[model samples]
Target: MKKWLLNILQCIQDIYQILKEIKALYNQFTIVTAHLQTIIRLIENYNHLAEEREKTVDTDQHQREIKLLDIGQVMKILNISESTYYRWVENGELQPRKKGKRHYYYLFDLQDQIAKCKLKGRL
Candidate 1:
């Protein structure tokens, strides 16, 4: 009876040690997986930013005669609303493009106009 009890205790101790080791291994695997995922996300974000930068540089190179500014940029630069901008266009005050309900302004022309207007206003 004493021998049987000793063997049973030994078996329980062995199982406990195995379970502890398995839990530790699982924790380590999870940590490694999380770290790898974070690295992949960082790499993907960097790649996207690099591609965007390259495209922007290419656009800058090819566009020499005219640089275009979309509506939001126009408003921010001129401090005006869409209605006023369109009216100016219609009255032939500021030349612009109206294509598919989107307006675009020529960058260099707009800058010249802003300078003249600021000079007149002493602003």
Candidate 2:
């Protein structure tokens, strides 16, 4: 009977060890699941921001195309003098269309030129 009791006690100890191991594994799984949820949230946020930026770019491009300006307005926007504007025009750096003796400039063209200059560190 003593021998049987010792065997039974050993069996219970084995079962206890297994239960502890299972609890540890469950804790690790919970931590990993939380980390995965955080990663998913970050990815979703990034995607949302990207979509917004794309929409803004499209809207900005459409607005620039629809807007038009004259030489004086262009000069004001560029913050340059009349002489400088004529100099650029003379140098063929800018081309304005003359409609019935009135020169007109496209806002989109000027914006593109400015963006290029900025990329080249000239503006």
Residue 67 Cα positional deviation in candidate 2, in Å, after optimal superposition: 3.1
Candidate 2 stretches with Cα past 4 Å from truth are 69-123
Superposed Cα RMSD, model 1: 11.5
Which has the greatest lDDT?
Answer: 2
TM-score of 1: 0.51
Q: Which residue pairs collide, candidate 1? A: none
Q: What is the TM-score of each candidate against the true structure?
A: 0.51, 0.53
> What's the distance in Å from true for residue 23, model 1?
0.7
Q: What is the per-residue lDDT of model 2 for residues 1-123, given as tens digits with 9 covering 90 to 100?
A: 699999999999999999999999999999999999999999999999999999989977786677578989988777678898899888888888788877788776687667756777655
